[model samples]
Target: MSTNLNQRLFNAADSLRSKMDASEYKNYLLGLVFYKYLSDQLLQTVVEQAGELLKEYNSLEKQEKLYRDFLEDESTKADLIQTLKDVINYDIEPDYLFHHLAKQAKQGTFQLNDLHKGFIYLTTNFEQFEGLFDDIDLTSRKLGQDDQQRNITITEVIKQLDEIDVLSHDGDVVGDAYEYLISEFASSAGKKAGEFYTPKMVSKMMARIVTLGEEDRKIFSVYDAAMGSGSLMLNVKDYIKDTRNIKYHGQELNTTTYNLARMNLILHGVDNENMNLNNGDTLNKDWPTDEPYLFDSVLMNPPYSAKWSSDDSFMEDSRFMRYGRLAPKSKADFAFLLHGFYHLKDTGTMAIVLPHGILFRGGAEGAIRQKLLEDGSIYAVIGMPSNLFFGTSIPTTVVILKKNRTDRDVLFIDASNDFEKERNQNKLTEKHLDKIIEAYTDRDFKDKYSYLASFDEIKENDFNLNIPRYVDTFEEEEPVDMAQVGAEIKEIREEQKQLQKELYDTISELTYSKEDEDWIKGALEVFKYED
Candidate 1:
């Protein structure tokens, strides 16, 4: 049933592809779906509260009418809304409900202004929801050349979303469905997707690795400095037993994506207070510079090789000061890693995705790598396959860093080849992820797949943490049998001799001029056996 609903939701997005690029159209489609989710939650809560409110209405139309009737009563309207606010900490008026707007759209009475007001009400009334709907441009000419056409387009989308029973299923299912839509948009967004989303398989892998042995904790905090869509942080929740006790901290440079991360967390039913999301550049500035700044786990997939203002000012910042040298301005991979690591608790685990260059790059990066290794802060380096990301095809490595690790050896897993090919992208399946998790948790060395490289071995190699230097994935070629080759060559030669003699006999049977026949026979002489 969830699969069917997900398809219908994606189809709605598909309907708008002719209007704009997936990068742009996704804002409208996802916005409405999110809006519908909020409205449905309110309506569902109302039904659950009133008990008799929706029980008689077998059809959505009747239920919506019933809701409209209930709201029309002036005596009960305020009391009902207050009750909803008390329960969910928010309320949507019946006039602005998703079903009502969808009904308006279905009847050709929908106004783009009405939807605009709904967005306005939420943003104006709530601080958390402020600027949330700013990305969904109802005024865009791309929706259509004019107002009525745009209304028709948005109307069609709302009506399509109306079919989704967002309240009939579990909140987690709805949230997962929302995630499905985000992923679909990400796939369509191509290179642009890196700005907002990470492939779920990778997120799951990092989540499992970071949450290992720490699953039973009553209160766990996870932070992502470059949190794209907040999926990585949410994955940490998936692996924890007490998900509700988890607090999420994230900062994104893109406002649109930050809004997406907010909606994602909210839909996942993360309490508003539990989400600490900021829309700003994580490198140029720092966030959560207050109480509870540190986290138990820091999971990140920052933009690879992205340029940052690595000014001398940042050297004074606590995050980068310890390294003595800064990550190169041209590649902020180490810079992001250092920031996330700084926010990690002494007992916390941090897993980050960076370009393979960080493993061996020289100069500033080399200096920083040496410091981390010397301090035994670097935990494990796992090399993942190329094209597993959305935009770039360069192979990436997940560098796991832990604070206060007594072990001096770093585990290296060469998982670069263990992925299922999915058309244009490489996917890490459950089996592939399980193998990596087993290897990571066991910390056991498997030849050609993983290795436990000691500090001495790393220093011997000039502190280069490249996987090839430690975990050798090279396959030795099978030994050749010279006698078998010689026998095959002899058999081929014997067959060739018989075939040549038969060819000469067949050529002798054909009629030709003497001069021409002699020329052909001369060419055939080159094919005769040596004997």
Candidate 2:
């Protein structure tokens, strides 16, 4: 039954993709998925409420009448209405729920104007819950060249999503499906994929590392500068059971991706009020001005080698003011690092993925690296293998920074050689992530895997924090076998002489036709006559 349902859902999505691009199809699919989630939640809430009323009237003679009266009570009615409002306020409208949309679609009366109105209704209803549907562009060209085609595509999507019982089934499956769609869209989007998504394994590793040893206590807050699809911030929730204590904060540069981040958070059951997503260039424009704020845990997998403004005006900005020199416009790796570092609380720990260039790049980046190390903020640097991301094949590294540390040494894990290649991409499996995290947690310096470099040693290298300089992952070649090599060379020379004689004989046979029996003699006579 599940297989049949899965096939039907996929087929519907495939048909929609035939009419629209993945980027456009994503809005329809994910928007409907969000719609289904709210509908199921609302239906479930109603059923639960109805069930409680029935239970109360089980022994009453006029049970039906009593139950009806119970539902009509002002307080009960208000509660039900409030519940519907709460769910709708989170991007689902009572009238435009999946079931309702499906019913309308079935009758063939659903029009593009209706769907647009439904979207507007949802946004208007949830205006208090900002950023919920900010990423879903209903009118984007990716959906269709015109409104009619988009409406048809979306109607089909609504019909398909109406079949899923998201609220009744296991929550993880629905969340996983949403995540799967996000990943699929990211892969198709190519370089743009990096704007909104991080591989699940990477997010898991970062979440695990940051939440280590604090399984019992709740993380106070979590933030990501490049939230993308909010996957990294959402991932931290998977590591712990109680997320009520952890508040999520993120800022995204892309409008579409920022909307995705908001949807992703809510799709995973995060309350709209708990997660804050701002759309703007995080480096230049710092949103959410509530300051003196600090997070207990932070994780980021920012774009690699992205260009940013390094104009003299930015020197006066608070994020770069302390650093003295702004990160060069060509490389904003350190700029993100500084932003994350500045936002980190005294007890918070941050792990960010950066291009390997940031480790040894010169000029302003180099100065920033030196100052960070000197301040004892860097904790560990883990080298990830190349081709780990979808767009680029360049190897990357994770720099773990901390506001407080007991040790002055930086732990370097040369995980560049540790991944298992799957198809064209390299993956860090659960076991691999576990091993790396275990080494980090234990602070054990295993040969080839990790190394603990002292502060003085790092200073000797002029504060260059490149992983290879500290983690010695280079393997030594076997000692040379001179006698064996020499014997092999002598035998090769003798074989060469025999091969040369055989070649001469073959050449002479081929060249000597019936008329030219001695080609060498004929050639010599011709040369003498010419002289």
Candidate 3:
């Protein structure tokens, strides 16, 4: 049923392709979708808890007795809303509910002011709902120059979203559709899109390796420093089932994307209490500061080679203080990694996506790599295929880190050859992703694909951890058969000599064997072999 539901939602998104920019449409449509889910979920809770009262009220209304008579003295509306708040931590008034607005829209009587009031009310009542609708503006000049046109456009999207029964199932239905919308928006958003989007296939692989043995653990926590749209963080929860023990912590730098990450978490059904998300610069001000960086699993996909302050004062910051050298100010890849690593629990595992430069770049980055290796913090390096990302085609690598592992060797997986071309971008199919997970799980050597490099081997090359330096994927050329080549050359010369004689005889027949025979032979000499 949800398969069809997802299809319907995507088709609805396609309806707006010509209406606005894909990125802009995502904000408008998904905000409506989120609003719809919230309103729908509230009504669903009311139905389950107050069905008897609602039915009685409806029966009374049909018999010429209005709802006022049934609820005049009881304050039934307030009672019901407070009841919902006790359980769901939020409430949507009757007039502002999705079903109510949907009916009004069908009759062409819906008011944009009503929705605006509702959104304002949401923030005024609950802190978590704040800024969710900030990115979505109904009165924006992009929507329309006048209120009437804007109302028409807004009504159409609300009606379309209302068509989706977000509360139809108890699974991640709404969240899955929400993720679909995010991915579609990112595909058309260009380089800026890479900031918040990590392919689900790659997320799955990272989830698997990070949560390998902890899948069934009753209590577990995962963190992503650069949370982006929170997809990577929530994706970590897909593997663990005991939600009671699940703790999610993350921080995003971009305010718009940060709001998106927060909405994504709630839409996916993760409770507010379970989430510890923050909107701040992870490098300058670390979130989860109260928790002291002890997550059981840490996942990150920070922008490649992003810039950071890298001030000398950071030399004293615990995350970088131990490394002996901070990452270059021009490239803060190592800075992001070390921040996540610092917060990781001794028993935790982390997987991060970074460019190949981190493996061999000299100066600060190289020193940091050497310190991590000597301390046995580096676990495995998985080379991803080029073009796997949307905007940039540069191939990236996923480096797995562990705080407590005793293994002194790094697993080098040359999975750069394992993706399929999808239109313009490269993607890791399930088969390709699964193979990487298997190689990582087995941690055994595979010819031409994976190699287990020891600590001494890394030290021998001056700590250059480039994949090609370890895993030999080179193919040897086949030796040529010189004797067979010589024989073939002789055969060709004999055939050429016979052809020349036949030509001479044909000429003799045409001229009665007397038409400038020597001249003809001399002219044909130009065609003879140089040797």
Best by TM-score: 1
lDDT of 3 by residue, 1-531 (tens): 566556665666665666677777777766777788788666555555655454553321131223223234376866766777787789866677776787789889999999999999898899889887898887787777799987887777676677676766545553455556655555664545666777778888998888888889998898999988788877777788786668889899888788878887887767788888888999996667685458999999998899899999998888889999999989999999999999999999999999999999999899999999999999999999997765678899999999866777999999999888876677889899888988898888998999989999999988899999988899999999999999999999889978877775665555425567777677556444432
Cα lDDT, all candidates: 0.84, 0.72, 0.80
The TM-scores of all predictions, comma-separated, are: 0.88, 0.79, 0.82
Reference-based TM-score, model 3? 0.82
Question: Could you tell me the TM-score of candidate 1?
Answer: 0.88
Model 1, residue pairs in steric clash: none
Clashing pairs in 3: 293-343
The residue pairs that clash in candidate 2, if any, are 135-259, 196-229
Give the alpha carbon lDDT tens digit for every residue of 41-89 in model 1: 7766766677764566555566556566668999877887888777777
For candidate 2, the C-alpha RMSD (Å) to the true structure equals 7.1
Which portions of model 2 miss their true places by more than 4 Å? 1-13, 18-20, 52-79, 86-95, 103-109, 128-150, 168-188, 404-406, 477-531
- Better structure of 1 and 2 per TM-score: 1
Q: List candidate 3 segments past 4 Å from native.
A: 1-21, 50-79, 168-188, 476-531
The root-mean-square deviation over C-alpha atoms between each candidate and the true structure, in angstroms, is 3.7, 7.1, 7.0
Candidate 1 backbone overlaps, count: 0
**At residue 272, what lDDT does model 1 achieve?**
82
lDDT digits (tens) for residues 45-161 of candidate 2: 554555655345432223333334545787776666676565545433445555666777878877666655666666676654344554456676666789876677667767676
Q: What lDDT would candidate 2 get against the real structure?
A: 0.72
Q: Which is the winner by lDDT between candidate 2 and candidate 3?
A: 3
Residue 446, candidate 3: C-alpha displacement in angstroms: 1.1
